[model samples]
Target: MIAASVGSILRSFVDGVIVLNDRHEIIWHDLSEEISLAAKAGLPISELIPSAGRLDFSRYRAHSTVNGVPKYVNYSTFPIQRDGETIAVFSLSTNESKLKDWLHQTIEIKRQALEKEKNQRNERNGTTFSFPDIKGKSLAIKGLIKEAQAIALHNADVLIVGETGTGKELFAQSMHNHSPRAKSPFVAINCAAIPENLLESTLFGTVKGAFTGATDQIGLFEYAKDGTLFLDEINSMPMTLQSKLMRVLQERLVRRVGSNEVTPVECTVISASNEDPEKLIEEGKMRLDLFYRIAHTSIYIPPLRERKEDIRFFTDYFLAYYSKKFSKYVPPFSEELLEVFLAYPWPGNTRELEHLIENVVIRASETDEAIEVDHLPAYMRRKIFADPGYRAIEQKQKETKKRPLTSIFSASHVHYIQQTLEETGWNISKTAKKLGITRQSLQYHIKKHGLGKRD
Candidate 1:
C-alpha cells in the first residue's frame, strides 16, 4: 500500500527522473512514456543520449527539441550513497524552457555590448589606418610604405604575404587606411580560427531558424559592407568555403547560409597569408582560382633581420611610449644599449620588441627614474651579449671586407638591394630589369653576397 501511494505521487510531477548504474546505463525512467514520445521512432530508454559525454552530469543545463518544439532541460546527477559507499546514480531533469529563453536573451545583450567595445577600440586606434607599430628606418620599409600608399588609391584587391608576426595584417590595415575606403569599417577575420563546419555561416550570415540555435545576425561579410574585409591566414580557409568566397568576390553578392536571397556588398577584400598562397594551392590547402582573384596586387613585408636599421627607431618609439604610459622618466638609450638594439636579431619582430620595452618601463617606473640594462628582460640581455651566430657573421664580414663595418657604401648597397627586391617580389628577372642588369648578373651578385635569399 505504501509503494502504490509513492508511485501515484511520482506520476503527478511533469519532470523526467531516471536512475542509472555506475556505468551510466539507465536502470529505470520515471517519465518513460514522455521520453519514448520525444525519441520519435527510437527507444529513448535504451539509446544513449547524444552529446552526453560533454555533460558533467553533476550540473548540466541545455535545451533540446521534442516534436519540433524547444524544451529546456536542467539535469543533475547525484551519487547514490549507500552503505557508506556510492552504489548507483540518481538523475533529475526539469523543464525550464522559459528560464532558458530569458538567460539566452541576457547573454545576447552582453555579447552585443562586448562587440561594441571592440568596435570602439578599432575606431579610436584607427586600426584600419595605422601600421602594427612596426619600428624600422630601413629603406626597404620606406619604399614598401610608398608602394602600399600608391596601390591604396585603386579598387583592386591586395594580398599581403609574410611569415607570422612579420606584420602582414599591419600592412593590410595600412593599405586600407590609405585607400578610398579609409573612413569605412575594416573588419578582419582569421580564416583558420573559425571552425571548418561553421566557416561558411560565419563569413555569410544565417537567417533566424536557419538551423538549430541560429539567430538573425549579420556575418563578417555583411559587417564589412562598403568597407574593407581583411582575411588573415587565408590559406587555412577550407576548400569548400573557398569556392563560396570566390563566388562572392566575383559576383559581389553573398547568399545567406540558409536563404535564397542574395545580398550585394560593396567592399574591398584584402587577404594575408603567412605561407605562400601558390604553394598552398599546389599542396591542396588553398584554391588557385581564389588566389588569383585576391592577388590583383600583392605586397611582401620583409622580416626584421633583413631590415636591421628599423630596430633602433622601433626601440626609441617603444621606450618613449611606454615611459609615458608607465609614468617613468626613462633616459634615452646609452650608446651601449643602442648598439645592443641594433645588433640583436629579433626573431619575434616588432611585437616582441614592443612588449619587452613595456616590461622594462613598468619595472623601472616602480623603483627608478631611468631604465638600465638590469631592467631589460633576460632574453634581451642574453641575445645582446651571448648570441654567437650574429657575432660570428659580423666578425667574418669585418675580416673579409676592406671598408669600415659601418661604411656608407655597405648601408646604401643593402638599401638598394632591398628596394629592388621589394619592387620585384624578389623575382630575379624583374629586379634585374629595374636595376638595369642582366638576370645572370643579378643571380651572380645574389650568390656572391647572399642578398635575395631572405625572401
Candidate 2:
C-alpha cells in the first residue's frame, strides 16, 4: 500500500521533479527539456535553475527569464527521509499554474463576498462612516484625526475648513458618529445649494404667514432636535443671515419666521466652509462674530496633493474597492502609472481619485496583467510627456537610472508657469486656462514647486 501511494505521488509530479543532495546539486532529475535537455545526475540544480541555491525557504516563488519574457515559477520541496533521518530532498515545480495566478482566480469570489458583506454592514450603520473608515496614514491626517476625535467628545459647535472635494462632509459625519449624540439625527444642508428665499426657513422653521405657500413646520434645527446640524458652505450664506445665526448661537434660541415664539436650541451646529474663514471675513463674506461662535473648535483637512503618501494610500484602497465592486480581476497598477498618479495635483482631491479608479475598473478586463500606461487618460499622458519639465526629469532618470524626480518640472517649466501667473496677475483660472490644465492642478504645482506670489 505504501509503495503504491509513493508511486502515485511520483507520477503526479509529471510537470518536473528533481532529487537533490545536501550540496544543492541534483542527484537525479526528470526535469523539463526547456530547462536543460543536457542536464544529468550529479549536476548542480543551480545550473538549471539559477535561483535554486538561494531557496532558503521550503517553498518559494521567483521570476525567471523565459523566451525573452519574465515568468514566475514556484518551487516546493519535500524531505526524503530514511530511518527517521533526512537524506535527500525532492523539489517539484508547477510552472503552468503559478501561485499568484491561482490566488488571482479565487480572489474574485472572495472579494465579491467580502464587498457584499461590508456594504450590508455599512447600510446597517446608517451611511455614516466612522474614523476608521477614513483611510489615511500621513502625519497631517493622523494629527487631524486625533484632534477631531477630541473635538467630537464635546457638545460645542465645530467649523471644518478644506478645499472642495477634500472631504469636509466626511470629516463632519465622522465627528457626528463619534460624538456623544451619535444616536441623534445627523442633519446636513448646503447653504450654497439651497435658494436664498427658502434658506432661512430651512434653518429656523417657518409659519403659515411667513410667505406664500408656507406652512407651520420645523426647520433643520428643530428637526435635528438634540442631534447635530451640519451647515455646509457657511460662507455663502448672506451677511444678514449670518447675524441672525450668530444671535441664535449666543442666545441658544431660534424663532420661527412670521412668529414671535422663540424655540430653545437643542442641537449642536457644525459649520463648514471651503474658503479660509479669515479670508472670507476680510472679503466681507462672513461675519466676525459668527466665525467665533461656530468655530469653537475647528478642523482643517489638508488636500490630497499636500499629502502625497495619502494619494498612494488611497490608490491602493480604491483599486481594491473598485475591483471588488466590479467583480473584475484587476491587477495592481504599474510603477510608471503610479508615478503619474503621485505627480498629479489632483485638483478634485480624493473625490477625483475615487472617480478615476471607478472609471478604470469598469473598463478593465479580467486579466492577470498589471494596469499599463495606456490604461490612464490620454489627456493626462499627453500633458506629462509634453511638459518640458517632465522631459527634463525623464532625461535625468535615464542618465542616472534613478526613480523619477519629485519635482515634475525642470527650472524652465517653473519659469514659464511663473511668468504666466505674473502675466495673469496670479489669477488661477486664467493661468490654468492659459496653461491648459485645471485650476486645481495648477494650484498643486504652484504649492509643490514653490512658485509663491512674486515679490
Candidate 3:
C-alpha cells in the first residue's frame, strides 16, 4: 500500500517517469496522458533520449517528434539501484513550458541584482571619467590638457568654455580627479536643466519653513566639502542669482534658504558654459563681477572641426571601441569618407562622432567589405556627397594617406610633419619623442608622406 501511494504521488508531480534496465532499455513507464509516447516494455532508451549516456543527468530540455506532433520535454535522470548493485535508471520529466518560465525568472532576478550593485558603486565614485578618457592627439587638445593639468593643482574657481558637445563636463571630471581633493565628493549640476528658482535652492540647499514644501538640506557647496562642485551651462543662470552666487564665491560661505546662519564652504568650484564669458557678459546674461570671480582660470576646449587630427584619431578609436562592444567586424572608414570627416564641420563634436560609429557598427553585416560612404546613413550621405573634398576624392584617389596608429603629431601627415620639422629645426629625435614614435618610424613616415626636403 505504501509503494502504491509513493508511485501515485510521483505521477501527480512529474509529467512522466520511466524505468530503464542496466541494458539501457525502457522496461516500464508511468507517462502522463498529455505526453503520448505509447508506453511499451523493452524499447531502447536511446529511442526516446537520443543523447542518452550513462553519465549523471541534469535538467535537460529537448524537442521530440515521435508523438506525431512536435513537443518539448524537461528531463532529469538518475541511477536506480537495488542492494548496492545497479539494476535500473529513473528518468523524470516535468512540463517544458513551466521549466522554461522558471529559468527566465531566475535569470532576470540575477540581472536586476547586478544592476543595483553597479549603480551603488557608481554613486560612491561621484564621477566616472578622468583625463585619459578624453581621447585626442592634436596640438590644440594636447596643449589644453597640459594647461588643465596645471589648473587642477590650484584651488581657484575655473571656467571651461567650449561649443556644445566638446566634453566640457569631461574636463570638469578630469580636473576633479587630478586635484588634491580626488577622494572627496564630486558634485555636478546643470544650471540650464533646472528652473532658475529650483537651481538656486538646489545649489544653496533648503531650510524648513523657507517655502512651501521646503525642508532642511545641505546644499552642493556644504556637501562637496574639500571636493569639487561642477556647474554646467553657467551662462544660463539668472542675472539676479549671479550676484548672490558671486558673493558666495567671494565669501566662501553658503546660507541656506530661510536660514539666518551662514555655513562655511570648502569645495572647489568648476563652472562650464557653451558660450564665452565675454559674449555672455555683452548679452547681459552674466554679471561682470561674477566673471572675474569664476574665471580666475579659463580653459578653452577646441572643437573637433578646429582640430582635424583629433577627428581622425577618434574615428579609428571609436570604430575599434564599438567593434569590441558588439562583437562584430567592421573595417575602418574609407579614405574618401575620412576626408569628408576632416572637412565637414562637426557641430556636435566628439560625442557625435562616437555615436555615429556606434550606429554604423550596429548596422554592419558579415558581407560588408569596408566602411564606405554607402555604409553611412541616408542623412549623412546627403551631407558627405555634397562636400567638395569628398567629391574630389570620389573623382580620383588622393595622396594624403592616414599615418599609422599613434600618429597624433602629424594630423595631416605631410603638412603637419613639415611644420613640425621646421619648428623643431629638423631635429628627428626630438620630433619623434614629441610624437610618441621611434626615430626610425618617424623617418619612415617622413618618407611615406614625401617630406623629402628635410631628408
Candidate 4:
C-alpha cells in the first residue's frame, strides 16, 4: 500500500517518470499517453531515452523523438534503493521550454541595465573636445580663446558669431568644458538641418497625441538641464520658431507642443550664427530682440584668412593627425605646395584645409616622400593659378617680404598713428575718418601701438 501510494504521488507531477532495473530495462513508467507502449515491460531504457545509455545519471536537458516528433526535456536521475543497497533507478524529466523563457528574460533585463548606464555616462561627459583641441596659436585665435575661457566661468547666455567653417561648434564645446555645469548634458542641434515643420517640436519637445503618431518626448532644453544647450546656425531657424525660443530663454521654462503645462529648465543657452547677426537681423532673417537676448556675452571668432599667420601651425597639426589616421608616412610639404596653400583664398577656412590634407594623405602613394603641388586637389590648384585675386595677394606678400624687420615696421606704424592723432587734435572720429578706416579699426590700431594718449 505504501509503495502504491508513493507511485501515485510521483505520477501526479507534470514531468515524465521512469523506473529501470539493474540491467537498464524499463520496470515501470509514467509518461504522456501519446508515447508508444507496444513493448513497455523489460524494454531497454535507451529505446525510450536515446541518450540515456551515455548519461552519468546527472541533471541535464535533452531532446527525444516523441511520436516521431522532436521534443525538449530536462532530466534528473535518482537510485531507488532497497535496505541501503542499490536496487532500481528512477528518472524524472520535464519540458525545457519554461527554463529557456527564464534565461531569455534574464539576458534582456541585463542588456537594458547596461544600456542605461552607458547613456548616463555619456550625458555626464557631454563632449569630448576642449580648448587644447582648437589647434591654433595666432594672436587672433589666442585672444578669442582667452575670451571664451573667461566667459565660460559665467552663468550668462553666449552668442558666438563666425563665418561658416570657422569652428563655432568647437568654441561652444570648449566653453561647456570650462563651465560650472561641465558634468551635465551638452546637447547641440542645428536649426537649419532639420525640416522647418519638425524644428519646433524637436527643440521644445512634443506630447503624446500632439499630432499623428506623436509620442511624449523630451526636448534638447530638458535634456540639457543644469548644463549647456548649443544652438548652431541659429539664424537659419524660422522667425516663428525664434520667437518661441526667445520666450523660452526669457522665462527659463518650456511648454511642450499641444500642451500648456510649463516645465522649468536651468541651462546655459549658447547660440551660434555663421552669418553676422546684424546682417541677419537687417535682412529680416532673424529677430533683433532675440539677438539682444542671446548675445549678452558675445565672442567673435576671426576667419582663417584674417589669421593667416596660423596656417603653418594648422597645416603641420592636420598633416600629422591625418597621416597617422590613414597609416600614411608623414612627408614634408614642398615649398611650391606651401606657397600654393598660402596664396589660395581658403573660403572654407580651417575645415577646408583639414579635409584637403586628409584627401592628400589618402591619395599619396608609398613611394611619395613629400607633398607637392600636384598632390593638391584640382580646385585648390585652379584657385592658386587661375584666380587673379590669389595671384595679386601672393605678389603683394612677396613684395612685403623685402621690407625692414617686424620691429622697425611696428615703430613706423606707431609714429604714423601718433602723427595722425596729433594732427587731428586727438579727435578719434576725425583721425579715423582722415585715415580712411573704421573708428573701431583705428581704435584697435591705436591700442596696439599705444598711441591713444592725449596730446
All candidates: TM-score: 0.54, 0.59, 0.65, 0.60
Q: In model 2, which runs have C-alpha deviations exceeding 4 angstroms? A: 1-127, 366-368, 379-455
Ranking by TM-score: 3, 4, 2, 1
Question: What lDDT does model 1 reach?
Answer: 0.73
Which sections of candidate 3 miss by over 4 Å?
1-44, 47-121, 385-455
lDDT of 4: 0.78
TM-score of decoy 1: 0.54
Regions of candidate 4 where Cα sits further than 4 Å from its true position: 1-121, 366-369, 393-455
| Number of the top TM-score candidate | 3
Give the per-residue lDDT of model 1 (tens digit) for 1-455: 77556656665763666667656677766653334456565645334243332334634433445678656565655677667666666556666676677898999999999999878858743473364444468899988888888988998888998877778887888877777787788888898898997888888999989999988878888888788898999988888888999999999898888788998978889999888777798899988899989999999988776776677667777877887786667655543355556667677777778888888776665334334567788877777658765476457557647655555336676678777887778888888798875454455456545675453
Superposition TM-score, candidate 4 onto the true structure: 0.60
At residue 90, candidate 1 shows an lDDT of: 59
Q: Can you write out model 2's per-residue Cα lDDT over 240-358, one digit (the tens) per residue?
A: 89999999889999999999999999999989999999999999888999999999989999889899889878888898888888777676675456667777677789998898888
lDDT of each: 0.73, 0.77, 0.79, 0.78
Q: Which residue pairs in candidate 1 collide? A: 136-310, 137-310
Cα distance off (Å), candidate 4, residue 347: 1.4
Ten contiguous residues with the weakest lDDT in model 1: 46-55
Clashing pairs in 2: 389-410
Shift of residue 407 alpha carbon in model 1, Å: 16
